[model samples]
Target: MSNYSTTTLVMTRVFNVSREKVFDAWLNPKMMKKWLFTLEGTNKVAQNDPQVGGTWEIVDHRDGKDYRAIGEYLEIDPPKKLVLTFKMPQFSDTVDTITVQLKELEQGCEMTFTQDIIVPHEETWTEADIEKALGEYHDGSEHGWNLMFMGLKELVETGQISYKG
Candidate 1:
């Protein structure tokens, strides 16, 4: 087994909304569930209170398989910033830090989502393994972030929650 250290993934989106509106979505649990899971086959997902030290869990099914993600909230800020702990089941027990930053732009708000983690120094993931993991991650994150920003825009413009099923 070869050692594995830090792995980081960064994604950015420009949403036609204000920074305040965009930040509120991450601080609210009900708003988060709307766009957090964008996979094609995901089922029900539930999130508890979204505050510092809060816990959350999600159950997703795809291709006749079930997977769960359980984690805790590490930091919370209103309408500006957020940080959370992420975990994946039946895989490496890696600890991840996710940060969402909102920047004001002439057109709208620019949001950046970054996920960083450090695996065991002695662990190794083959090229195929890395590719598979990243594929799933990209699918989930892109969909999740897009949906989240959508919900944020709706809430700010419509004054109602339209993302809920």
Candidate 2:
């Protein structure tokens, strides 16, 4: 038996738009910055190469700090599914995997997003430290995703960006 556990965040949201539009939002630089990282910051970089084995990098400057994330596309199926490796060096060295699946609906599309993260166990980590780390990670991820999805729904449905910062 292994003494390791995985930290996973699963989220689902339905958008009133075509599957293609919803899918493109994940790759399109303009659409991504509008919804994905609309915080009070300047998007210094939004380079996306949406192809198998292709990599992407985004850097956002906020409040004298830089938040950057880099990833590579593992799988890409148009308007349906995408799998990628995500890493934020500012946070941790561990690389996480994200899987996004889009299903066509009667009115629009439904998106199922999942992020699988491996939280390594360290000899110096106590139980409380582990719990705290896990809780923070989950909360941060959930909050960010929820806000991003809200922006996405608004953008795709109304052709407007709600959160401008």
Identify the candidate with maximal lDDT.
2
Q: Encode model 1's per-residue lDDT on 1-165: one tens digit a residue.
A: 245455676878777778887786665555555445423235467566677999877666766766677778888776667788777766768767888888889977888888875455423677667666666665665666566556556665565555344
The Cα local distance difference test for each model comes to: 0.67, 0.84
Clashes of each: 1, 0
What are the per-residue Cα lDDT tens digits for candidate 2 across 1-165? 134446899999999889999998899888777766654246778888999999988888888888898999999999899999998888777788999999999999999999987676676788887887777787788898898888889888887775677
Candidate 1 minimal-lDDT segment of 10 residues? 34-43
- For all predicted structures, in order, the TM-scores are 0.66, 0.89
Candidate 1: regions farther than 4 A off: 1-3, 38-41, 119-165
- CA lDDT for candidate 2: 0.84
Alpha-carbon shift of residue 140 in model 2 (angstroms): 1.8
The TM-score, computed over Cα atoms with residue i paired to residue i, of candidate 1 is: 0.66
Return the clash pairs for model 1, or none. 3-121
Which candidate ranks first by TM-score, i.e. highest?
2
